[model samples]
Target chain A: MIGAIATAIIQATLVSAVYALIAIGFTMIFGVAGVLNLAHGALLMAGAYVYGIVVMRNIVPSMTYHPAVGVIAGIVVVAILSLLLYELLVRWVEDNVVITFLSTVILAVASTEFLVWIFGGQNIRISLIEGQFALANARVAYYEAIGFAVSWIAIALLWFYVTQTDDGRSILATSMSERGAQLTGVNIRMVRAKTWIIAGALAGLGGMFLGFDSGLSPLMWLNPLAVAFIAVVVGGIGSIKGSVAGAYLIGFIEQITVELIGNGFRGMPTLILLVGFLLFMPQGLFGREFAHE
Target chain B: MPVLQLEDVDVSYGKTQALRNVSLEVEEGEIVGVIGPNGAGKTTMLDSIAGYKEYSGSITYDGTEVSETSSGKLVNDGLVYCTEDRDLFPYFTVHENLQMGAQFRSDDGAVQESFDFVYDLFPRLDERRDQEAQTMSGGEQQMLALGRALMSDPDVLMLDEPTLGLAPVIIDDISEALERLQDEGLTILLVEQNSTFALRHAERLYLLEQGSIELSGTADELRDDDYIRDAYVGVT
Candidate 1:
């Protein structure tokens, strides 16, 4: 029982980290652009598929399913895809965020379905680093631990970048007021395009890590999408710290539900939590400033 | 040649004409004030020069036409517009807000130099360099807005209502800063509801009313006119 509890704690932390990575990207995009991209889930799916393709095609045959490679591939693939999206769709309709969001949804749904048609609906496992280690009486998967650590590192790096650097402060400024940003010579369009790319890369990386944690499947995007939505909504829109906190809150609750009730009931607690947050903290904990402004 | 000149400018928002036949100029190192009631096309005139709104007119700066450039590109050519209202990026630190003013400067050293120069003008910004802009006092934020414009190292700077809502002391501070900028050979075009303040800063002034330039002359001439004083300056 002690071992099971330890394993559960480890699992929750790992899962929360992954969720944070995904949620951070979503929050950044929404916060900066004031666009609720329903298609962010599609970006996640696309990243996982891209990784699966890259590995299967032996583009990097020497590369195994190492967490590092997954992360690198995830970030790179998502960044490229995000750039493509920016050049092709985002720039043309940035003024109409609602339309841009709807267009992204179409893009996501089409791409996801297309990938499913190409890769088949069945699960395809990326072979892990060959072995599992024992922690107490429970067996801890190496890939899982790696996933957890990589996600935390990514989140930390992002927080530092967003809060510390010149470019990051520009993003924070853009989130506050686009006109204000422009009056100060902040090339609002460029800032936004760069934001989309960063958000995509982070989402992609998170998806790749998630694929390693669980075997890739056609419906893979749904889980991350749900978690990201929950995280962003609960954490508050445009608040990075809030997103991270929300991720952990949802993560631990899901773990607790799975361990205590049943795997089938796990989603119920998340739903309840989301509903509760919406009812009580609709702006998400720190979003009150932006709620009316 | 004038530092900035607008010739027969026509600007419209869909079918609504915001500025019609608006022509004006600001000479080098001169503080030109534009005053009018609300909807007098004052903001539109500034917007047209900044490239935020399109206009059918010849806008020339230092003898170069500027109607074709974008707002960002215009800054590169040394045209800076300080918008009305405290439009500082609320989430950014005071230092970052100033840095944004130099976003187009490709030379890192020049950017750094500009930052220092702006800091010299607004030492309060340097004192609270790392604090988020929104948390600052209103006067500090206004100073930040002015400092941000100066950071672009512009040859001509346009200010739109630098003091809208603030304590009387803060207004005096803002007015002093504008005067100092004018004294240091920085050319400026100021738009304001405070006719007294505008007359105080500007050597020459234009009174706008209902999208037209109703009166234009030296500050002393406008101040001496009874009708101008009755309409703009309060009768004390």
Candidate 2:
């Protein structure tokens, strides 16, 4: 029983970091642009497939040199895709909340069909750093270790950007008060573009790690999307710190339940948490009203 | 030549007209005021100049067309608008708010000097640099807003309702700061609902009523006019 608890702790911590990455991007988009981005999960799936294709099939012979190439390619491809989505569609529909929401939902559903067309309906595997090592009582995979480390590095780098650099701080300022941002010479359109790129990069990294665990499929985005939704809502509507906190709490609860009960009950507890939060604490842990007309 | 000029300006919101055949100009290193009651299109005129409202007119600011530029780019060109809403990032510290005002400026030395100037101008803000903006009093917040705009080193400052909800003592502090700024040869286009406040500092005044310029003259001429004294002076 002690071993199970200890293993659950390790697993929970590892998974929570990845969830934090996903939820951070998710919440930042809503906070700044006021768009919920239902297409976020589809973008994550795109990242995984991009990594899988570059490393596994090697359709482009020149690009199959190293694992890092695949990683960069995955992240860059998704970032560009997100920018294209923004420039082409989102900028026009973003003013109307209902239209933006419906547009993203349609895009997400269309992406699933597009993925099935390209990769077929088969669940394809994407390998990263393989081999399991023992850490105290828990046996952890190299991929999980690398995922946890990289996730922290990304978070640290993001923290530095927002707090230390002017361009990045503009993003934070706009999230707080857009009119203030404009008064300070911060370009709203340019700020939105930067945010989409950053969010896409984060989703790419998280998706790459996620692909190693469950393999790649067109429909794989649904579960992570649902988890991100729960995490953001249970945490707070517009707070990045709340998203991180909620992700950790949900990850721990899910892992502990899986360890104590069974694998089938993995998602049951987080759903319960979401319902309880909505019913009792709708404002969430740190929810604050956004100033948008 | 005027530093800021608007020729035959017309502004509307959907079907309702806000300003009709409005014409005004502010010359270099002079103070001008637009005085009116609520919904007299005073704020709308400033908003149109700052790239917030749609206007059909020729607006030339420092030799560039206002309509052709984005609002943020206009700020870079030194057209700073200190709005009635204050529009501050409440979570940021007072010092951080000031930093944001000059975030896009390329001249480090000028920005540093402006920081010194703003701090000197508003010692209350200097005393509470680390405090969050949302926690400050209304007068202090107004000072911070004006100080933040000062950090931009603006060529022309357009102020909207700066003394709207402040104590008499706080108004004196703001008045002193404005006098100091005027002494430095800063060109300003002031908009006020408080007629006395406008009359106090503005050399030239334009009285706007029902979306048009109802009267225009020097401050003394307007003060002597019976209509001006009866309508605005008594109420505000």
Candidate 3:
């Protein structure tokens, strides 16, 4: 029983790390742009496909397939795609939430279809790390360990960027009040575009990590997307810290439920928790009441 | 030559015209006041000048045509507008709020200079610099708003109702600060609903009514005008 509990705890931490990585980008896009980017899942799929083509194709040869290069390529491709998304689609329809939602939905569908066309309808795998270790009577894959470290590092870097950098402060200012930002001579368009790019890159890195750990399929993004959306909403619609905490909360709930009941009921706890939070404590943990502003 | 000029400007919001063929100028280092009743196109005129509203007219600032310039560009060009609402970043500390005013400026030395200038102008803000803006009183918020505008080191400062919702003592303090800023060679175009305050401070005043300039004169000239006295100055 102790071993089983330890295993559940380890699994929860690993899973929560990945969820946090996936949900941070979604929360940021919503917080800064005030647009629910439904295409976020699609962007993750695009990143996975990009990684698949770059590393899994064997075009670079197994001897020369550097994981760093693959990750950078994935991030760069997604960042460029996100910038294009903002300029071409989001910028025009940003003020109207419904239109933004519809446009991003279309983009998501288009992206998924594009990926299917390019990569075919088969699952692809890229092994990031080659070993596993035992800890407290539970086994942990090297890939999962690396993913957890990367997620925390990324979160730390993002927090520093947002709190310490001038451009990041400008983004916070714009999120607070567009008119106020304008009066201060902040180029709001540039801020918005940069925010989307950062979000896309983060999503891409997350996809790469997830694909390396569990393999990738065209439809893999959907579940993670749902998980991220629930995390964002449960944490608080626009709070980064809330999103992270919410991700861990969901992750632990899922792992504990799976350990106690079974895989069939794994999703039930998160669903219930989401509903409870939405109904009772809408602000989520660490979320401010004026987050919408 | 005037530092700013508005020639025959007209602004409309949908079908309702907010400003009609309004023309005005602000000479360098002068305090020009615009006073009018509510809905008299006073705020609309400032909005048009600040590029927040669309208008059909020529607006020239510092010899450049600024009718098409965005508000962000206008601020970088040294024209700053402090709106009546005091649209501050409420979550930020007073110091951070002031820092935002100079976000686009590259010269750290100049930015620091402006910060010192503002702190000197309103020492109360310096005292509460670490406090969040939303926690302050209405008068302090107004002071922070003014200090924030000054932090941009604007060559031409446009103020809209800086004394609104403040106590009479606070109003006097703000009026004295404006006088000091004007003395320091800042070109100011002030819009106020308080006709008495405007007449006492402005070198020249424009009386706007129903989207048109009904009267324009020196402060002494308009203060004694019987119609102006009865209509705006609250003297029966």
Candidate 4:
């Protein structure tokens, strides 16, 4: 029983790290650009597929193929795709939230379909680390442990960038008031583009971890997308710290449920928690009261 | 030649016209004031000049037509406008707000100099530089708004009602700051509902009424004019 509990705890920590990585991008996009980028999931899928191709197909034959290279390539490809998405779709329809939402959702579907065509809809797994370790009667995979460490490091780096960098502060200023930022000579378009790129890179990095842990399928994007969205909503729409907290909250709850009540009932508790938060505290735990349009 | 010139400018909000054929000029090293009652297109004029409002007119700054320029580019060219609403990033501390004002400038030395200049101008802001702008009183916020505008190192500073809700002492402080800024050769275009303050500070004044300039003269000339005294100066 103690071993089972320990395993559940380890699983919860690893899952939370992945969720936080995915959700942090979602929250930042919402906070800075005020758009719910449903295509975020598509970016993750793109990253996973890119990583899969790099590792499995050996895209660069002359160079030694490493898992780290796959991860980096995934991040770079996703970042570029994200910038393209912003320029082609998000920027044009930014003023209209409904249209932006619809366009991104459609894009998500199109990207997933494209992935299905390329990968033949099969679960493709790439083993970055080929071993597991035992701790307190609980076993943890080396890749899973590496993923958790990378997630925390990424989160810390992001936090430092946003809070300590001049460019990042300009983003925060733009988020608060577009006109105010413009008055300060900040180019809003450039800031938004950079934000999309950063968010995409993060989603891409998270995608590599997700792909390593559970393999990749065309439909794999939906699960992470749903969980990340839940994390963003529960933490508060615009708060980065809240996104991390919400990720852990949902992660632990899901793990505990799966351990105690069986895997079939794992999602039920999170759904209940989401509904309770929406009903009682729509602004979320860390979200400020946004101005009404 | 004027440092800034607006000729035959007409601005409209959908169907409602806010400024009709408004023409004005501010020469280099001059403090030009636009004084009028509420709803007389004072703010609209500033908006049009700042490129925030779409207007059909020729607004020339530094001898270049500026109707098509974006506000951010305009700021980079040293045309800064401080809106009436104070439009501050409320969550940012006073110092951060000032830093934001200089965000686009690549010259660190110049940015630091601008910070020192603003801090020297409004010592109160320096005292509470770490405090969030929203927590400050109305007067301090106004000071911050003005200081923030100055941080851009503007060649022409357009102020929209700088003393709208401040105490008398605070108003005097603002007036003194404007005088010092003018003395330092910062060309100003001030719009004010407070005619007395405008009349006292402006070297040249334009009396705006019903979206047009009714009278334009030096401050003393307007002060002594019978129509200006009765209508704007409250001297029956």
- By TM-score, the best candidate is 2
lDDT of each: 0.81, 0.89, 0.86, 0.88
CA deviation > 4 Å runs, candidate 3:
A57-64, A289-293
DockQ-superior candidate, 3 or 4: 4
- Give lDDT tens digits, candidate 2, residues A1-293: 77777788999999988888888888888888999999999988888888988887533445454678888988999989988888999999998999999999999999999988977878988888779999878899998988899988998898898877788888888988999999888998999999999989989888888898889989988888888888988888767778888888888999988888889999999999999989998767877655333
Checking candidate 4 for backbone clashes, the offending pairs are none
Better of 1 and 4 by lDDT: 4
**Model 2, position B8: C-alpha lDDT score:** 89
For residues A1-293, write the lDDT of model 3, one tens digit per residue. 99999999998999899889889889888887898999888887777767767776552344345677778888999989988989998989989999999999887877777767866667777777688999999999988998899889989998888776667788877877778888888997898898899889988988887787667777778878888989998888777888899899899999989988998998877888888878998777766554445
Candidate 1 residues lying further than 4 Å off, grouped into runs, are A57-71, A90-101, A134-138, A288-293, B106-120, B123-127
lDDT of 2 at B30: 89
lDDT of 2 by residue, B1-236 (tens): 88899988999999989999999999989899999999999999999999888899788898787998988888988889999999888878999899999999878999999999999999999999999999999999999999999888898999999999999999999999999999999988999998999999999999999899999999999999999999999854
TM-score of every model? 0.92, 0.96, 0.94, 0.94
Tell me the tens digit of each residue's lDDT in model 1 across B104-211.
Answer: 667888888888777777778889999988789878988998998898888889999888787888888787777778788999999998888888899999998877
Ranking by DockQ: 2, 4, 3, 1
Q: After superposition, how far is residue B111 of candidate 1 from its true place, in Å?
A: 4.8
Clashes in candidate 4: how many?
A: 0
In candidate 3, list every pair of residues with a backbone clash.
Answer: none
- DockQ of each model vs. true complex: 0.55, 0.83, 0.79, 0.81
C-alpha displacement of A116 in model 1, angstroms?
2.9
User: What is the lDDT ranking, best to worst?
Assistant: 2, 4, 3, 1
Ten-residue region with minimum lDDT total, candidate 2 chain A: A57-66
lDDT of 3 at B63: 79
Better of 2 and 3 by DockQ: 2
After the best TM-score superposition of candidate 4, give how far the Cα of residue A214 lies from its true spot, in angstroms.
Answer: 1.2
